[model samples]
Target chain A: MKIKSLTMILLAGTLAACSGTEEKPVDQNTPLPEVETVEDEAITAIPDDVDDGNAIDGGSDDLSFLEILDDPTSPLSNTTVYFGFDQHDVSGEYAPTLDAHAAFLMEHADLQVVLEGYADERGTPEYNLALGEKRAIAVRDYLQVLGVSANQIEMVSYGEENPVAEGHNEAAWAQNRRVKLAYSGR
Target chain B: MIRVNVFFILVVLCGFNAAVVKADLTFVVTDYVEDAIPIAVVPFQWKGKGQLPGDMAKVIDSDLSRSGQFKSMSRNKMSSKPHSPSDVQFAQWKRQGMDYLVIGSITPKEASRYSIRFYLYDVIKKTQVAAYTLPIHRRVFRKAAHRISDIIYQKITGEKGAFDTRIAYVTVEKRKKRRLYRLKIADSDGHNPKTMITKSNSILSPAWSPKGDKIAYVSFETRRPRIYIQEVATGKRTRLPSFKGINSAPSWSPDGRKLAVVLSYGKNPDIYIYDLRSRKFKRITRHYGIDTEPTWTPDGKSIVFTSDRGGSPQIYEVAATGGRAKRVSFEGSYNARPRVSPDSRKIVMVHRDRGSKKFQISVLDRETRSTLVLTSGALDESPSFSPNGRMIIYSTAGTRSRNILAAVSIDGLVHQRLAVQRGSVREPAWSPFSRR
Candidate 1:
């Protein structure tokens, strides 16, 4: 049975590889994932932190000075991004925060992080679980666009189980539906 | 019309009577009983030693009352309490307008055992209907009472009873900024709740094995969701294959040899059949949308699940052997968590009521293709069918606590609730009749 399943996995991998020749040929052991579109423009700072962005980017781009992560004033300090009701799209407003975090992650390539997704207590837990994953994936897509490697992010969704605010009102729900960036060992 | 209230002096016993070690859950009930088969349950004559461990009559009476089928005559209304049919005055009960009469006596045996004998009588005909004497240990005094309730229910309704079955649920509480999740199992009446797993992580979607000896659930103790199967008797756990992304919603197949689990493989979630003996997972559906909450039809031919392939979440059916996925629900924009009845005629699910915009429990008739909402809660989810498929138990927004477990008859006539003292409970899974 083990051999049969292994053979089936190999066949699936081979079929996926053959169906998408445009996909990277380097990895034939897995299926081709949806390619993320990386924006060509450099990262932008939130309007309120234009002066701070300049001072942080003044050095060589290759340098991995991650001091901005500890700086309370840096936009990178805001590790969480909130979502609207039943929405997974990373809003245009959160782009600056995502970009700053992505730039920091791109410089610190040796470090890895986990994007933890969550949802409010409105919907069924299983459906909310998938919604949470979609929320995390949206953040992951934005980070990839800012040049963060996909391998550096691991997504874990808590669904509606882990709630920051326990109230049953919309104020609590809005705070519950979110994704937070946390450092990972890998 | 005058409303009647029933009071039961509940007894809390320790240790499990059957497969568990210990037990915690508190329950109070609110029911609507109108024109139910009026019956009288005379307190069983327990004249033995130090306070009988538990009241057999209270347990039996409570079961009948909550079922919304029989309204036990209030104790204060009964002018005479009899211990047997020979001692019963049928004219007196008939005068009180009770259709049926119940009388019993208990004899305590040495070493914490009881010889319980009970009877049901037709007051109008003055004929003895049914009698049973159950020799039981004090540990199983309540279980024995439930056993009597099951027999009485089956005899009067000519159908199977689910009073002796069990339900598994998940509880979550936030303490000191940390979350604690626990999976618990208890009697059908929400008594003797035994903790199966307790940790400072997230646990959800607990499903009982067909034999009622094991369970499958998703736990996040490792900081990621992974499916695990645990033995109810020994509390042994075995983790299934965890992929890169999500590994949640593990459901046991009816025959108990395979599991219908949801796996994302680091991308889109899909349903898969995992064979326990072979330890192999065969992916069934391929879609970009989230396909989860899989439940197998009792016939084991098809799997009904919730999917968002059509923009909004809806129920879909896919052949177990791998085929095209067909949408099966059209009543509303959101219908999920489908649990097929044991008889294969109806399906209970969590549906968003189009008018109220609240998630409620609804039943769909397979032959008619129509849906009927059964609950009126702001948020109701995780509906599981009783072994007989006559009732559905789910967790919903609670008036007793923040969240509580509730049950309703398939006909939507009766309602019952089980609440804990602290935290909240969700994801209730009812066990099949323990064939043993």
Candidate 2:
């Protein structure tokens, strides 16, 4: 009976050790798969603009610098996109700008764009940072739906740290809450 | 004629019932010590032609109760509502076991102008202990009530009251498509908010000078965030030196000669002290990562700021002349906004847990290096202490999608919300003690 009791204790210790080791390895390894799934879902959500190849083949390689600058229909031109107060949701009026930018991205596959998100100064600095990030991500997601590659675009949230207007009135606030599209690389 | 007499008798009964209802307005102070001094706040007599708008007695009652020093009795047990010290019957209050009785009356001085005369009496001694009169307009009746509370508080505790001071905070209101930014200055108890600065551009980090004559804050008015100092008494402002890169996090020195701020004009953000007397800026910290949120020690010899030069953000202190910064907080992964207490012995900062999920306001004992968490909320930041170092005011969010300014005693016992509406209010900077 004593020998049997000793064997039982030894088996319990080994099982405990095995369980502890198993948990440590699994905990360390599980986050990568979860991240991969999130990324995969994001990729699948991309729009048909990139798949159709109509968005990137429009810009001519033979155009001179002055002609490119003078082109009124160039997607490379700057445009203003508006967002709601304390929110990063793309407004209904600004959807067309994203669509145009997506078309530009499809036409110029070599050109990279950066989305700069800003908030009106009203909330805490840290919260504004997060809000700005949300605004930039929202715009990026919409552009992705238009078939723009996620890798070709970068997003940065300036929060309320940058503003285009100085007035405290409604007009100024509307101007301050925006995401600007800037071309980074040719 | 007989019907008229019957009507008069019914009117008299109704008047008596109204008087009884008015008598129910008494003040009680709870949460006191074992041998707390018993005080009573009598029903504030209306001096206006119309009925009183708000409960003045209740405001005074709660203000004194939250101090944790006085024991106020219930109004139901009061003998009478005396308009002044002469009208008070000392024997009645003495019989009810009240050591002190407060009597006050409001008298209309002019059109919508009123003066509140209040008296504190020692019932046992049968003599008036204190008497004062405050003249106020109809719009400031609540402030007069708080002023009366301050008087009573000072008489009993021998410490000056903070009721008359003001607090400056940032208020964010979202319109249909734009976010509005407003810098509001309100009474210390969060009443009578007046907008000092309003802009669509974001404003943050308001710091009051030691003299309380001017305020320094960060504004994004010029397309980029820059520090601006505005005079409180006069509507004058002065912009600080704007460099090429980042300009944020402004803190005033104790003597008001230099302003400690963070500037990333070079490579990375570092602490810089701008001397007001010389009008010259000097970089105090040279670090690779972010070193911001500079707060001066009371003595003006050292500065305590947040720096991630140690891998993660932690509280560090360096000489005003700038040298090696010694890390003060070691337990938390994130500790920022280090506000030194009035006595300069304790440091209050926002501390984040290991995973950075929960952020709380904590007090670090400088002597022992032991930390005490003062708040348990999900996110509580920007803690500024009252001038006397007895209480701290910080911002926290509750049930709704709004930020609320809250205050608690340094010991974390007394807690109260400052805002009345459901809008977001944050970055509370407490004013210095009133000069009198």
Q: Estimate each model's TM-score.
A: 0.84, 0.65
Stretches > 4 Å off in candidate 2: A1-186, B1-38, B44-59, B66-71, B74-76, B84-99, B105-117, B122-129, B133-145, B420-422
How many pairs in model 1 have backbone atoms within 3 A of each other, for residues 3 or more apart or on separate chains, i.e. clashes? 0
TM-score, candidate number 2 = 0.65
DockQ of 2: 0.03
The most accurate candidate by TM-score is 1
Candidate 2: tens digits of C-alpha lDDT, residues B309-427? 67666899998987778999988777878899998999998887777556788899998998888777766888998887877888876555466777766776555555435456788
Q: Write the residue-wise lDDT of candidate 1 on B349-412 in tens digits.
A: 9888566568899999987989988888878989999999988999998763378888888887
